[model samples]
Target: MDIRIGMLGFGFMGKTHAYAVENLKYFYKNLPFTARITALCTAHKDTSCAACAEYGFDRACGSEDEIISDPDIDAVDVCTPNIFHYETVKKILRAKKHVMCEKPLAVTYEEAAELARLADEAGVTTQIVFNNRYMAPVLRAKQLIDSGRLGDIIGFRSAYLHNSCMDPNKPAGWKQTGEYGGGVLRDLGSHAIDLVYYLCGDFERVSGKSLIYYRERAGMDGAVWKTTADEAFYITAQLKSGAIGTIEANKLTVGVNDDLSIFVHGTRGSLRFSLMDPNFLEFYDGSLPGGDYGGDRGVTRIECVNRYPEPGGVFPGVKAPVGWLRGHVGNMYNFCSAVYEGRQAAPSFFDGARISAVIDAAERSDRADGAFVAVAQP
Candidate 1:
């Protein structure tokens, strides 16, 4: 049985979902069911329809409802704008379909919680597509942390710094507004928080600041749009495990490539992971004696394996030297299989909702001038 996936949204996330659908069977073994890109949906009829044809979708749907109501599709992958996630996801779940939505779950905390609740109530399986968790090196890092190789983590730093849209002339879209999921915290910090939870434990508290680097930008309609959201975020958090950490993300970083690195100092050792060097993880063990020796503290490259099942080719695995693009594809296969087979999925919507709550707490803390705020654990 192949799980039929209908992807909605044809932008960055749309193409990513499509790529994942197009490459699911090339990596793993024993997928409970086969997966296929059954359809594509977008608000625009022509552009979306063209994308559907170009991407080899079986068909193109004109509306989110059209895709959700299509019984032939087993799941609807939502890559649409964050402001639309809550309503879109609520309807999809009501249609008794599984979903793999982009991060934040919703543009606002209330909406996120409602969507999370609805997904849970529907019991139809859902994931928020925290794709970083699927990164091979990140997985290896988790394994190392679980083994206590990093010892008792005393301090941690996870930052996602990139310079993709630093220019004022970059124009305004859904991401530039404060209300429409338009902020640095929700846009990028969500991933950081999720990574924090994945690598370490839940957050005990977080206190930080978020700033909108640019005040305004050109709109698609050649009008000036307010850039009320932060282009960067700076936050310090306390993990429930007693480890304090800093999580920062900036779109203003010059010459950055989606750099997400976590530095940890433990009681006995330390380890680090940078997304640019996705293949290898770096670890320094203080337990080993060093007698006046000069050693390199460079990060070790642990290439990712991209072997997947039939039709899921080039999917993410232990293969080192893999890229973030492959991880996106692998994530689709994971969620689709989990939905069809009635099993587990990584970074489920609950994880999404929880991280959203963390962001909410951070916002509260920011309002209070960087006071500690406890994160709710599910």
Candidate 2:
């Protein structure tokens, strides 16, 4: 099977997805299908045309409709702005095409829910780009949690922070504007919320607070403008399984760069992971017997590294250190494989909608002066 993707948007995520598709075979041996980006669609025609020629795409499309309606396109890979997701995804599903959408599925829960429903009715393979879940250490953490090593998860704290938004003089992009759904909450909070929800259970209730440390900043056009979105978000949530934790996403952190870390505590053990230390997982076993010499009571660093499953691990070797991009590759492989096998992918639109619902609830909570809000069911 040849899984040809129609790539929308020629930005950061576009390049990332393209790299993932182009390099899948090298990392995963004995792939069941050949996956490639066959068409390119961008905000500008010239750039799209140039991308097609440079990246070996067969065609350059002026609009998303061209790619969505293309007979040769097996899937629509959405890497466009947050504001474009709902409509683009609806059209792709209406066309009966598979979709690989980036995170925070839609700007609102209603839109996300409708997309999830449409995907289900279409019976098309779908995946949301919660790429962090593909990290080896993160996967290992899931394995341990499922195995009951961290018996009955009770609490967790996770945060994703960056310092890029701290400088008021820096020109802002679409992400810093409210109209395009730009904000740290939806940008980074979506990941943090998903990470916790993936390990913990469904959210029961949440209280959230948003802050805008820098009220004024240069807009995309370099004009001084008032900030319309949050620079940081703090959330306190209760899970359906009776666990409670704090989740945060902040861009005003003075000295942070792609820093995402999580600490999960349970009845029997605890697990810690940091994106800064991509190769290992820190685990502490409360079940370890106490001794006068403190025998085996300390945290053990498990070297998860690039230890992907068969068809992977071989390229970089299991012992090799994997970086952030490895997760994207793994995520792409999973989606493509599911499509080829005619199976629904994990982290599907359902997962995306659920996360978006939590986000919506959190925003409402922020507006209500940090009052608790219930996450709506999909």
Candidate 3:
């Protein structure tokens, strides 16, 4: 049975999610159940129409409530903006429909927590899209950690840097305004935090430095504007497992896919994953006998595996079809599976809320000049 889907918000993430859900059947014929974009939502009819036409959504609506309230929508996929996540999800849950929302589930920990409670009461499954967890190298890293190959993790470092907002003249978008819940920390830091939790377990505390490198930038109306949001973050965390790690994210890097890569070391071994080369993972085993004569550690490639309705030539993470939605594709697949089978997937609302709290804690630490703050639960 094809799971009918209604997509909310049709911008970058919306388009991406639409692409994933639409082509899901092509990638995995045996998907526990199929999914189709039965409807779409955007803030305006023109935008919604354009997106529906471009993305092949069966129908489009200008308002979120309209789409969520529609009986035809089996599940609501919220992709509007960070600010809308909490409320839209609330309505969807109250309507007794599953929800698949983007990361950093809510603007604040309090909001996230409340939504989680409501979802439980609504008896519906909810998932936050932490797509990076589906990436090949990252997934392999998780497997190694789960297998205890990287024993007694001693230290770790990771960062997601990019040049998207480097231009001081770049006009403000929803991402640059605090009211819209825009900022590098919550906008991009959520992925990094979730990646850390997925591979290293829970964290005890976080200390951070968040900077708005551009105090002012051109506004949407071509006027200079003061910025209230962070452009980058430098964070340090101490995991509950006794491992120390650093995570950084920036949208103003001069030129690069800087956001890719995490280097990890343990008392016994080490691991490395880079988004630049999404296909490979490096590993080192200190206990491997007679390794002194050879190299201490080496890199291994993780072929892009996928699940099966395969357009059959080559696709990323082909080994796991669900992983195909990694960036958004695998994420959508997981969300659909959760909706269809009544299964709760990874990075649930509680998880998203927790990560938001972590970011909030980091931001608080940043304001206090890098004070170490406890990473409280949501």
TM per candidate comes to 0.78, 0.85, 0.79
- The local distance difference test score of model 1 is 0.80
Candidate 2 residues lying further than 4 Å off, grouped into runs, are 323-378
User: Relative to the true structure, how large is the alpha-carbon lDDT of every model?
Assistant: 0.80, 0.93, 0.81
What is the C-alpha lDDT profile of model 3 across 159-188, one tens digit per residue? 888887788797889887888999999988
- Give the per-residue lDDT of model 1 (tens digit) for 1-378: 879988888899888777766655555545677788878888788887898678777888778788899999999899888888888898999999999999989887888888888888999989998898876567777887889987888988889887855777767677767668767778888888888888888989889887776677776465777677788999999988889989997888888878888887788777788878766667777776655454544344444454323444434433434655658769999999999999989887888899899999999999989999888777
lDDT of 2 by residue, 93-146 (tens): 999999999988999999999999999999999999999999999999999999
Better of 1 and 2 by TM-score: 2
TM-score between model 3 and native? 0.79
Rank the models by lDDT, top first. Answer: 2, 3, 1
Better of 1 and 3 by lDDT: 3
User: Which pairs in model 2 have colliding backbones?
Assistant: none
Instruction: Give candidate 1's error at residue 356 in angstroms.
Output: 58
The candidate that wins on lDDT is 2
Error of 3 at 292 (Å): 5.8
Instruction: Provide backbone clash counts, one per model.
Output: 30, 0, 19
User: What is the total number of backbone clashes in candidate 1?
Assistant: 30
